[model samples]
Each structure stands twice: as C-alpha cells, then as structure tokens.
Target chain A: MKRRLFLASSIAAALAGCSPIGTALNDNAGFHHALGLEGSLDAALMENLPGLAREYSIADISKNFPVDSLPTPTSVTYDRLLAHDFQSYTLAVVGAVERPLSLSLAQLQRMPQQTQITRHDCVEGWSAIGAWTGVPLRRILQFARPHRDARYAIFRCMDRDDQGTPYYESLDMAQAYQAQTLLALRLNGEAIRPDHGAPVRLRVPTQLGYKSAKWVREIQIVGSFAHLYGGKGGYWEDQGYEWYAGI
Target chain B: MQRLVYRYALLTRLAHWFGAIAVAVLISSGLQIFNAAPYLDAADRSTPTRRVLSIDSPADGIGRTTIFGHSFTTTGFLGWGSDGNGGEGARAFPGWLTIPAYQDLADGRRWHFFFAWIASLAWLSWLVSSAVKGNLAEMILRPSDLHKLWPMQAYYLRLRRDPPPHGSYNPLQKAAYTFVLLVLAPLILLTGLALSPGIDAIAHPLTMIFGGRQFARLWHFVGMLLFVGFVCVHIFQVLTQGFFNQMRSMISGWYRLREHESVGP
Candidate 1:
C-alpha cells in the first residue's frame, strides 16, 4: 500500500511537471512572448549568445533555391521607384537613433560587405540554399547608432497585404547585431529578381524564412512593438505565426 | 501455487509511462505540423537530374500521394482541405488527432516542443539509470537468445500452446524494446533537431547528413508511424499474454509467476 501510494504520488508529480497546460497558460498571457517554441527555445538560445548561424561553402549552394511568395509593391512610391528602375529609391533609417539617415542603394552598397552561402529553412517545412551578398546589418546598425534604450530593430517593407497593410518584421537587438545578418542586395552572383525579394531584403540566417522581411523600405529602432501594426512582431506573426521564428 | 517476483523497478515503470505520454503528444502535434505542407516531391523536375524530396507542392498546387508511380488526389484529406465554409483550406491530419485540434500551427508547435523536451530528458535519465542498474545487459539480445525467438514466434502463432520457459522478457519483446529505445527514439530526436532551423544553423552537418531539412521531416513522419505501429503491437501482445498480470507487474512492480515457470538464465 505504501509503495503504491508513493508510485501514484510520484507519477502525479511527474505529469504535472511535464504538462503543457502551464506553458499554454503562460503563452496565452503573452508573458512568454513570440509564438510556439519561438518564445521558449528561441529566446533561450538567443540569450547572450554570440553568432550562431554557420556559413557554408559556395559548392554547397542549392541549384534551385525556392522563391517564397513575393508580394508586389502596390504603393505609388514603390511603383514610381520601380518605373525609374529604383534609381531614385532611398532606404530610410529612422526611430531611436542619433543619426537617422536615408541611404540610396548605391550608397548602401558602398558600405563594408559580406557574402555567405547559407540555408533558408521555411516554417512550412522546406529548405533552400543560396549565396547571399550584401552589407552586414551590424554595420548598418553601427551607422545608425541605435539609442541605448532601443531593444528591437523593425524592418518596414514596401509590400502590402490584400488589406493594404504594409508588411513588417522586427528582430531583437541580439539578432540584429549578429555577424551573419545582412541587408542582401544580390543572390547567386546576380541582382535579386522580383520573384525573390528584389532591390533589398533582410537575410537573417538564424531565423525562419518569414522573418527575413523582403522589399525593405525603412528601418526603425524601437524599445517595444506594442504600438506597431497588430502589436505582434511581424506580418505573419500578427496572424498567429511565431515572431521569434529562430527555428 | 504461484511465486510473486519483482518484474519492474519503480523508476523504470515511471519512465515507461512518462515516455509513452511524451511520444503520444509529440506524434499528434507533429502530424499537425506535417498537415501544413503535406506533399513530398521526390523528384525536382526543374533540375531534371537532381532527385531530392521537397515539401513544396507540385505545379498544380494540389497535394498528391504517389504509390509505385500511381498518383492520387490527396488534397482534402492529406495536404489541403475545406476551411469549414466551403473555402479552400490546408489540413494535414484530422482535428481529433492533433494537439490543438484547430488550424493554429504556432500552438501545435508549442505542444510539440514542450513534450519533446520532456521526452528527451526522460530518455536520457532512463539510459543513465539503466546503465547504473545493469538493466542494459538484460535488454540486449544474446547469441543463444536468437534460437529462442523461433519458438516464441511459433507459440504466438498458436502452433504451440505453452509459453516458452518464462524469462524476464521474451526474445521478441527484447527485440521490439531494443528497436524502440536504441533505434526509433534516437532517430526521431536526431531528425527532429535536424528539422529545427536554429539547431540546423549550429549543426549543419547533422542536417546535411540526412540530405536536407525536408528529408529529415519525412523520416520524422515515418518514425512516428512506426512508433504508433509498435504501440499497437505492444498493447495487443500485453492483452494476449495476460492483460491483468502484465498491467499489475508494470503498475505494482510485482508479477505472479505460474508454478511451472522458471526464470531464464
């Protein structure tokens, strides 16, 4: 009887410890932040972590890298830029910065650059490898000189959804400052095509594909994403996808 | 008269039940994720020569199931479905079998990762404890034990009524347990880690070894199916051998041995 009682109690304790109910409750409260494993595992993995994404050789690149569903820019500003071959286009760097600068494509390309062949894993269960060439996001952040209170870097995209809400994504300071994170201008030795994120796109190798905001138009440094569109971190994130998307 | 013998330790029993629950959760939630992208394109016709399985849908954007070169429309049941309003939807596994039972991929992932962590921890602890307790030796098959498997199979097939001389575990049981613990469990965990984008970045070689992330996902799905099959067979065997006795042994750590039975050497 004593043994049975002990076994019963131990099993009950184990079940309680292993239950998802507690985690689900915490998730519902938004105390955990992000979505799914992103809030837990991704956050834990990024805590004070140094550059985590690995670079691959050019030989490892996939011949046919998948082009994710690209949204065409319907705004007049984007259409005018596209009409003029993006010659008059400028990337605006704003919010929580000492020097809020607007950089043209050529000017941005002149900055210190890094090229990496990395794998892009989609959350929907596909992977593609490609060679990405561009300036490191850390260099851009350094140029912007983010304020001490700035905790997140938000990417404002030119693309809009069916509702005309502009697509946007954000990265925590740690990820933004990662060595591999880039504002990619080229893929596979050529200028990025329209099917892929053309002109420029954020390439966060550590994150899932959706976190790499395509057709980036603006960069905003913010302390919190509470006032942003939908309050969640990204376009997909607002619609139930995980914001941290590291996996 | 029957002799009461200790068949399982408290920790072992606890681990067994814990592992079972963890696997159940993992499998169901995994199916939910699989439903998100259900098509497997073994041949990327774009490249013509390069053959690799992809989770991307075919040209028509409709998911298909191919068996020995015969293809069938698996959209509604397999990869895509109706959103309950006659609109096109994506549903992999049915709602009842999934963790959230809704189309929330994020929630499904949380449930999966939560249980995956628990299961992995339990498995590691079980391995360490089993080693310390010298239980590993009993679980492994001996050269002579190979001979016993035939007779056990014959008995199971009803060719012989009497059960082979009682042992800690029958040859078939040992084989099944060994496969589950040493093979399927490790494969599932490794493949799962390979599928994680964050983990893949750190451990590129692990994913590369499996060809890619999609391949890892495919193998992980296959592993879940194998695990379900194993559980079904395990329960059936338990019921046929003596349901109450097996249940009592696992629950109470004591099994009543028949008078004619002798523990194996």
Candidate 2:
C-alpha cells in the first residue's frame, strides 16, 4: 500500500511538473525568439549545402496532385480574369527597383523558360511531384534592376484567405536568385488551372509549399516586409506559421 | 545482505531526467503536429489509394479510425475528443494528449522543435561522456550476453529461482538500451530531418534512403511509437524489480540491491 501510494504521488508530481512546462512554452516570447534564431541559423547552414532541390523524372509525377488553396478565389476580378483566359492580366513588378514594370502573360511566356520536375512538400506533411515550366524569377528581377537596398521579394496574390486577407509570401534575395525559383506558368504541359493559381505562381522548391504564392499579381521588392501585413512577412506567416518555411 | 551500491553516476542521472522531460514534450507536441493531417500514406503523394491509416469525422460527427481496410470507432478518445471543456471536437489525437491541450499546430511545432534541441543535445552529451568514461560497453549487448538472454527472460517470468548474475544491467536490459540508444534514437532524428524541405535541399539522399519524403514521415512516427513502447516496458520493469530502489538510483545515484542479489567487494 505504501509503495502504491508512493508511485501515485510520484506520478502526480511528474504530471504537475509537466503542466507548468506546457504553460511556460505556449506563446512564450523567449521561446519564439529562440526558434527564430534557430531558423536563421538553419537557413544559413543549409545555404552552404547544395543550393539546389533535387529534380525528379517526368514519370515520377503524381497522378493526383492535391489542390491546396481552399474555396478558390471567387472575387469578380479573379472571375473576370479567368473568363478572359488571363489575357488581360498584367504582373506588376514594383517597390525597391530601378524601374517598376508590368508584364503580361504573353510577355512572361516569351522569356527564357525552365522546365523541371520537382517535389512539393506542404507544411501539412504531404508531398507531390509535378513538372513545372516558367521563366526564372531572377531574369525578371534582372529586367527590373532591383536596387542594392532590396533584400526580399514579396509575392502578392489575388486570393484572399478565409478572413478576407490577401495571400502573400516573401523570399530573401538569395532564394529569389536560385536557379529553380521560377514564375511558374505551366504545370504538366498545360496552363495552370484557376484552382491551382492560374496564369502564374511563384515556385520555390527550397521552401515549403506555402511559400509558393499562387495567382501572383505583383512582385514587390522590399528592404524589409516587417512593416507590411502583420509584420510577419506573409499571410500564413502572420497567422503563427513560421516566416521561414524551409522546414 | 542488502547492499547499497553506486549505480547511476551524477552525469547519467542528469541526462536521464533531462531526456525524460524532453521526450515527453516531444511526443505530445509531435502528436499534435500529426493531428494536422491525421493520415499516413506510403507513397510520395498522400493519395486515397496509398493511405494506410487515417482518422476523421464525417457529417455524422462520429470519429473513426481506419487502418488499411479495417475501421474502428475511436470516438471521444482518438478521432474525436475534448480539451476538458466538455465540448467534444474532431481532433485526431485529442487535446489532453497534446501539449497546450488545444489545436495549435504552430505552438505544437514550436514546442516540438524546442524540446527536440534539448533531447538532441542531451543525447550528444551522454554519448560523448559515456565514450570518455568507457562505459558504453556496459549498455551494449555482446556475444557472451547471448547465452544469458533466455535465463534473464525466464527469471523475469518467475520461472527461474535465481536471477542471472549481472553487473549494473541484465542482458535483456542491455539489449533494450543498446537498441533504443544506438539504433532507434538516431533513426528518429534522421527521419525527422528528411521531413524538412530545408534539410532535403541539402541532404536529399536522406529522404531517398527511406524511399521518399512521405515514407520518412511514416518511419519517424513508427520510431516514436517504438520509443513509447520502450518507455512503458521500462517503467513496468522498474516497478516490478524495485520501484523505490530504481527511483533512488536514478535520482540520488545509490541503489539498494535485494538480499538474494550478490554483492561485489
């Protein structure tokens, strides 16, 4: 009886100890700050190791690639663009640049195209491989002549999340210049479907799927997106997800 | 004669306790993370055909867990459970089983990664310390231990009158510790790294070794289950053998060997 009581007391103490840890960890600024530091360190170390994401063969493409964005943008602007086959759509390149320019779908398609098969890893722990064809984002950055002060490229999309906030994502200059970073126009030889970010989407294989902002309307180069949209850098990033979705 | 022997060293005790806390947090947070998807697919893409295990609540509000072709109603415990507010929600692992006891994937990931660092550092320190002290051999099962495995099992089963003569740990204990520390732990870490796209950018081969990224995720979950299994058996052993003595050894580094157990000079 004494031994059982001792065991019970010890377990109760251990459990009591655990509840404090949970309370201490939840929404703790210090822990979040530490996590951010770790993320930066991780990004720096990963930059040193092969800067390229492994590409797969065409045969490895997933037959049923899941669509991530829910409720598909139902805005009049999106519907109008979809009706017109995105012919009237113009991708504006603004902010921290020598020259702000607007390029149409036809103009973007005419640029140097890179076609590669790569895997898409979502933050929800699902993966899908698909072939994407598009113009390298660096070429567009070069065309616009980004100012030396530019540190991040913010991809603003037309789709609003559940709360009516516009979807946006950002990448550092280093990630923007990556060979695989594309303004993807085509998926699996066909023009991107409306549900899958029709006309254009940013394809960042190095980061998680959320970083690949779809239905991109503007590419705003900025010194820091900390001042823009919740100061966390992106829509999901503002909603408690890590700004650096590399993991 | 009952003898008091110095069993666990101070370093060992510290690492053990630290690891225990870190592991508990990691497991709970990890389950919370898994609750985001609540399905395991062997293929690269999580298609319906390849899904081996899944938990969900349909329009009926009844939670069900499906494994392969078999389905089980795990309502109120697994697929559907509450956060202690009497409001039963459709969460895979339930709130009580997770850190923060609520559906917050971001917080869960934060907790998971934070404790992961702690666990990894402790494991690294334990590894280096044990190697320096030349005490790693004590945890490793050897050819000589092969013969004692059956006798140890028989003793634990109460089929043998006398327990096997061992120093510090029995042969079975050595095997369990050997596998958990050397094989399982490192594999869990590696599989975890494979799930990260950042890590994949650097070490893509790590994902390929497990067939694919999705498979790596599956293997990582399996590794967590194995760790849970090991912990349950370990606690059971501690309770059966001598709870107070085992607890005292782990806490204060002194163990009281029973009268039947031989004592060294």
lDDT of 2 by residue, A30-134 (tens): 866775565565556665455578899988899877898755789999899999999999999999999999999999999889998989999888889999999
Q: Which ten residues in a row are the worst by lDDT in model 1 chain B?
A: B43-52
Q: TM per model?
A: 0.83, 0.94
Candidates' C-alpha lDDT: 0.74, 0.84
lDDT of 1 by residue, A1-247 (tens): 5655565576556444432443344346463343354365656764445546666788767788777654677678777877787788788999999999899989877887788888787787666778999989888889889999999999999888788788899998988998889999999988877667778999998888898889998999999998998999888888767676865
True A-B contacts kept by model 1: 0.31
Where is model 2 more than 4 Å wrong at Cα? Answer: A5-24, A27-37, B83-86, B260-265
Candidate 1 lDDT by residue in tens digits, B82-132: 332335555555454565555666766776777787899889888889889
Looking at candidate 2, what is the lDDT of residue B74? 89
By summed lDDT, which 10 consecutive residues of candidate 2 chain A come out lowest? A42-51
True contacts kept of each: 0.31, 0.50
Q: Relative to the unseen true structure, what is the C-alpha lDDT of residue A194 in candidate 1, on a scale of 0 to 100?
A: 61
Query: Which runs of model 1 end up more than 4 angstroms from their true locations?
Result: A1-38, A46-48, A51-64, B3-6, B41-63, B73-90, B160-167, B259-265
